[model samples]
Target: MSTPKTTVHYVEDKINSWQTRSPFIILFLASLVGVATGLIGSLFQIGIAHIISWRMGIADSEFSNIYIKCLVIFLITAAMGAFSYYLVKKYAPESGGSGIPEVEGALLDLRPVRWKRVLPVKFFGGLTALGSGMVLGREGPTVQMGSSLGKMLADTTKIKNKESQHTLIATGAGAGITTAFNAPLGGILFVIEEMRGEFSYTKSSIKAVFVGCISACIVYQLIIGSSPILNIGTYISVPLNSIWIYIFLGIFVGVIGALSNFLILSTRKFLDLFYQKKEYFFVLTGALLAGFFGLLTIFLPDITGGGFLIIPNVIDELYSFYPLLILFSLRLIATVICFGSGAPGGIFSPTIALGAILGVLFGICARTIFPEYDIHLGTCAILGMAGLFAASIRAPLTGIVIVIEMTSSYILILPLILTCVTATFIAQTLGSTSLYSEILNNTLDKLGIQRK
Candidate 1:
């Protein structure tokens, strides 16, 4: 018979304890976390680029015979996807999808950070899934891995201060985005804006975020060079007369962003319903989707892969209205399916591309309609990216900063702000909650984790 106190203690809810008076030590550890995150993020970026290049090379050149080429591509991609899903299922299920939700849950003490399992699984699994030509981004995995690294260091160093741990994790996450997109300020703002209610903002925590972002930026620049993430050439600021046009663009992408979120949530529930009967089918489904997208990559590469590389082309108006529309529709579907299927990747890159395409399409019509005013199509594409991101993530400031940083289009800050803010307002009015927050809530509910 167990003692009453022991029984009570065993059943009691666990809480993370906090401490103070270690600002210097926490700052130092935060820098270390940023460095580690940067190194891993850079390597992850390089690895994915290599795999994508290899895959594209084979598709473009090697197998002259169509059947043989298709077979090889399918086999390669299917194997990659299978391996990624297998790792998520066996080693770390928390790494199954865009890891941002898990990190958010961790921040609020609603989830566990199994770093030992998450680090390797997320690094390799994300690499394989994104490399296999899925419409996914590396940023999500990097962020998750960064938070894990923070927790790993805390655990190893025996840092029992819960507040310090939270700060470190926040720092790591901020640095991870900086490394992923080469946007230090945007990364810092992301932590402040997107994580507003969750983060315990303090003087030391803010300083730690800054230090971590700068360190991550430096490390990433050392490895990946100091260039912006996207090579979309800068454009002249939109004429005052044309600024109002972007509001329409914002409204359009906002509605689409809401629909995208709905689709993602719906797909997850539908898949889970079917998956409950046969757990083994999950990996099979992922591999099949990868193989299907691999084939699509050969036929029409625009709709396949993360939307980063295609941004420059879209900005340049490479695709006409009909083709761009088809590409956008196909990619929207692919992005939602790939992300919703529990693949360890992100929706950021894909969303950016879709927004750009949609923006360009809208621009084509706008230019024709308003022949009196000079409108820049590329600028419209950039506005699209910012607006959609702001709408989907509900972080207008972060979206504006990240768009400017990624494209180095500083002259259009005013337009970016207009688009982002309007889009956010429209999204909120339409009842489209934050994507990551919704994902986190759904995830916690599914796991039967209650938080008040």
Candidate 2:
């Protein structure tokens, strides 16, 4: 028989051994979350693409009566929108809107994850909403669904540790962004910069984020060929003397971004006043909006969808100054209508498209004024992309890195930094709230939960 002291010593050693190995175990689980997120996100992307193709193919098929074709397309899109809105109303309301706010709330332990409901609802609802050619991006659904997966894994495995849960969720979120844009650095920076308030920057957590991002990127590349999301061709470096031009562009974007945020918030509030009493009306309104956009898509495809198809064309100077301005104005209206109506989509891509349009307009005017500087409109478009994102999101590093990764134009780093920094400063000086923060507060207010 062993002495009492020996027994005590043996138990202590066992406890120490398990403690030492627990971090590795958590990390392994996080990696699994990353892999799962990547697979699901890629599938989501493929599903959206397939649906869009099918819709377009049907529309383009030879039809004896053009009116029949329009009616069929409108009804189909309206039905899709109705089903998507129904999912949000019936299943998981948290899955509605750009899910970044929900994820942020979850990080702070202020909101319930409801992963079982959210995962399915977001996946299918996003497919329907995006498939109907709404002005939305997949990043929102992917990030929300990814984070839900992490929470599901944790709950299923019965992990009670708070830090581990937070780490895993953050990992999944970062991986989601990585797979969405195929930009690993942007994913990592999003976690570090965008979720700074809720994320705990522990050594273990940081390592877990890195592993998750890398794994997610690898899976994404394997499925969706490795190419920059935006294949805009390279451009000559901006002349040193032209740096001032970017500063001006940044200032202009900063004002527009602030105004955009105000309008989005106001529109949401205005719409809510009309629909808060009858939830079904909100859903039907969304359907009507979707149908209207369907009509618009047939007439003017440029202003609908996630705005990706129109971006490259805009950068190539396909539109003159007045046309660019008109396109921007129409898109601004579409973005506010789609996003303000609480459609399960993201504003990120729409903002990017608007910024690109504004930049091209500015560039066209600049080139006309300063004929000697050899101004490249494409360069201005790229800068505007990052500048507006930086100002609106208030995550300049993430915005800059994402634009660089998506465009594969690291040579514009100086201008990107200058533009993003100036935009951020001006936006802050103007007292504009960060987009996600405003959304989170709105959500919390609705829940009757005071911020901790």
Candidate 3:
């Protein structure tokens, strides 16, 4: 026993002693990347939460006059939106969108990863944009910022090898996602499954991603607590006899997903035409957009923000069929506008919220028609999330894993799989492509930067 322990120690020491971008050094850098990414991601979440709570509190508060309250809300959100839009437009133009495409382009050497400009712009811009009652997610800024940190660290450590730099950058991206959803496995799978063509698969690269993901999750939990990202809560298992119902649910969700993608792309083109007319007007449009959403937060709170709070309410069956349908339509429109306007935010959270709404809608109808069978509405909401995401993003495995890890519905893995696969198949059959891939191609076309 003593000899075995000594040999193990010897091997560890020898590995640690290796330098110059060796496996040990690379992995060590990856952990550092994770720690830093987690710290920034936690801070971003905290700040956004504070901003939203403060804004919404006043919106819901009883005031002497409603006009004054509306004006105050509008002004506050407009200021935040203006600030965010100005930062991205003036400092880092590339920080305008999800930033995932930019990172992917950097990995393919088709785009520049200017960390110095991106870090501050994406961080502050995303914080303000997401907090200003915009229907946006935090994952976009965190993922981009995480990858920026990877590059920053590589440059600081004088790691000139391109492949090693790629490893660290990819690690940071994974770690950032892990921090966002508190899902380490989901983060790693995002890089592996979603970025399959870009990420280099090697024993060391996979190990680095694992190390980064674990470290990021540990640091995030240390600061934010180890809680599930969504509040749907654990639901009971679904009956096998009712499994066929999920396939139809998936088909519905896939149609919605594909429609969402088309709307976003078309919206961007339409908005770009406006920007061509006058750039400052385009920036001011962000402020006006934020102001409108802020007003809605007071009146129609259902469609404001990233839909995190509303998801639980929908899952608990708070709305009737007509109300739910209206909410879903408005939210889908809001999500597309916010993201397509080139706001520094993610579509992930809003997309999940839409799925939950669809799920609950389907559940209500199903239970009414099939009163004999036990239909779990909450379970449908969960499957809606995974299915819609898989369909739109074209990454079924990542969507399934992410929903599983975020919701802790491990017992429903089979259901999740069936829903995601069916959803992706339907989306593809309907002529829908991966959302990010098309966006990246469009950007490259505009810039005349051909992919290498």
Candidate 4:
């Protein structure tokens, strides 16, 4: 009996060794992560939309008075903000901010994973914060949550190898982007460009990221259908002579981008002062600010949410120069306030919207200034997308690819590249740190803020 058991164990070990070394098996598992991430991310999006719409329905009716509406929106948003804060304060403080930093930190093994706590806290907490109408992006939270899912998969599979662990984390991050944008290439580029420091980028890791992004995209399309997130119609590219305008636009965006980063960091510093010892007041203030945005949504409508709805409107020449300027100014302030409040949303979408508005304004002004040079508003809008993203995040390649994917405007690649490069250079020269890393450092300096 002992001899027979030993033989069986030896055979099993041989089989396990072969399976572990099989490239195909690794690829298959990575693809599995993609599918899971895509499905989960899509569900997350759908869930958030449902919640937002439901809340809006309640706010739109029965609260006819502007003052009353503002008050109610404020209270509701405050509660949501407070709830999000409490979750971060209690369970996974590293889950706060954009979450991309935590993902990066995880790759460096500087963070600990309590996915059981973070995954739920970020998901539900994010929903509450985002649904409250703060000017936050969903992509950041989604990335964190998706990566957490990857870690979960690794744990369940008993993957002990460091290489496999890195591969899986990359898989989750790629899947998160794919699910968010339905752009597989963009998702992969995100890992390469935005999280380069955290990424190992071995052949194996690259394959895993590729597999995960593609699978997530497939899953998302199966559910949401393969359509660009923004349904902007066909846009004619700017003429070669007109391309210089985009370069100039990029330079302008660089200055604004640097300023924008400064403003955001400054806002955080200011808000931190209020929240440091006064936790309840801090939470309440966040709620009140969200409520204010909620009321503004009902009244202004253009200044609320993630700012996606406002992009097309800004680019379509629906408003004149002065009005566009006003919109830009107000939205910028609102964006800073909403984002600085420590909500579980992203600044990506909002920054895109801001850039679009700036481009449109620049286009209108340039066209008026130079009648001989025909300025394409749509082209400006696209450039704006890349420039703003590059300026704020300091990741030009990711910004360019993401905008292209979101708009399905591959024809603008040259201008996009030029503009993104210029924007990134300008922002970097001005000395603004990458947004996610900055946020992560902020969270870490606070004692008890453990990242994973």
Best by TM-score: 2
lDDT of 1 by residue, 1-452 (tens): 89999877765523112224445778889899999999999999999999999988888886668899899999999999999999998899999888888888888998999999999999999988999999998889989998899899989899998888888888889998898899999999999998887889999999998998999999999999999988877688788977888888888988988888889889998988877889788899879988888888898887888888788888788888899898899999999999999999988888888889988998999989998989888899999998999999899999999989999999999989988888888889899999999988988899898855
TM-score of every candidate: 0.94, 0.95, 0.95, 0.92
Q: Which stretches of candidate 1 lie over 4 Å from their true place?
A: 1-22
**By summed lDDT, which 10 consecutive residues of candidate 4 come out lowest?**
443-452
Tens-digit lDDT string for candidate 2 (151-254): 99999999998889989899989999998899889999999999999888998899888888888899899999799999999987777987888888999899
Instruction: Pick the winner on lDDT between candidates 2 and 4.
Output: 2
Ranked by TM-score, the better of candidates 2 and 4 is 2
Q: By the lDDT metric, which is better: model 3 or model 4? A: 3
- For candidate 2, what is the lDDT? 0.89
Deviation from truth (RMSD, Å), model 1:
7.4
Looking at model 1, residue 333 earns an lDDT score of 95
Clashing pairs in 3: none
| Whole-model Cα lDDT of every candidate shown, in order | 0.89, 0.89, 0.90, 0.82
User: Model 4: clashing residue pairs?
Assistant: 73-291, 74-291, 78-287, 137-346
Error of 1 at 294 (Å): 1.5
lDDT of 4 by residue, 1-452 (tens): 56988999999888788866755666778898888888878888898799789878867778557777767776776677778777877788777777887788788787766789988888888888888787888888778888888888889899898778877877888789878877788889989988887777777788888988998998999998899988887777768987877888899899899999889888988888877776576567766776677666677878788888878777778898899899999889988887776677778888998999988888888998888997888789889988999999988988888899999999999999999889888888888878877876776776456554
How far in Å is the alpha carbon of 105 misplaced in model 2? Answer: 0.6
Local lDDT at 150 for model 3? 95
The reply for model 2, stretches above 4 Å from the true place, is 1-22
